[model samples]
Target: MADEHRNEHAAPHHITPLTTYIFVFVARAAGTLLTWFASTVDLGWMNTPIALVIATTKAALVILTWVVVIGSFVWLGVLFVLTFADYLTRFWAIY
Candidate 1:
């Protein structure tokens, strides 16, 4: 039965081209530089959202490049949960 199942299903294979890897690396580096530059600018209320957008884009790129699509979604779900938890606990004035 095991042999039959193995024969029925082919092994998973993924081959990313070198250029794709190089592009991802460059994009990540650019995202880092952009994040740093955003910190220097005084956008006041816009700063946090801008930073979050940049960070999310970088994370999505990494997740999609290195992991399966489903894995990316799972990771994003976990991040959302963590962010929500942090938001919920922020106003805790338990003195």
Candidate 2:
């Protein structure tokens, strides 16, 4: 009777498959390698955008796998808006 009572109070067990873990790890590694490779080449104006895209992809993977807070995207959106605003306000394109 005591065993049955203890069992009733026990938390449920969850098992994540090894394959899923392996896949995420491999993908993260590939992303890192690609970022390094991108740095070695000279694409002039395209470099910054390429790096940002790769970094955002890696951040998405990490957020999806670990972070539970959905509200964090609000900050990210704010940052993007401010960055673009600053970018647009620059007058360095003067003739």
Candidate 3:
């Protein structure tokens, strides 16, 4: 009875495989479309920033929909570490 109770309280991995496939397909499609649209515009210096923002948004949506909130948090942590590395390198270059 105790085991059953514990199992019931566990985080449910209820997302079906087909749901994951759909999410990946949708994200890829949206990302590609955004890239194509952005290319047609003359944002110039803002192009890279716009593309990165769009890509990150698509990635986050896919991650949240398919892998859930926990996976999104883990990805955010990785992004933070990479950002910190960039900051450290910039600071060290002053020497």
The whole-model lDDT of each prediction reads: 0.89, 0.83, 0.81
TM-score of each: 0.72, 0.57, 0.55
Tens-place lDDT per residue, model 2, 27-80, is 889998998999999999999999999988988887886655567777777999
Clashing pairs in 1: none
Specify the highest-lDDT model's number: 1
Model 2, runs deviating above 4 Å: 1-15, 71-95
Best-to-worst order by lDDT is 1, 2, 3
Q: Give the Cα RMSD of candidate 3.
A: 5.2
Error of 2 at 14 (Å): 5.8
lDDT of 1 by residue, 1-95 (tens): 65655754677778989998999999989999999999999999999999999998998887878888796688888999999999888877864
Q: Per-residue error at 78 for model 1, in Å?
A: 4.1
The C-alpha stretches of model 3 lying farther than 4 A from their native spots are 1-12, 17-20, 86-89, 92-95
RMSD over all Cα atoms, model 1: 4.6
Error of 2 at 67 (Å): 2.1
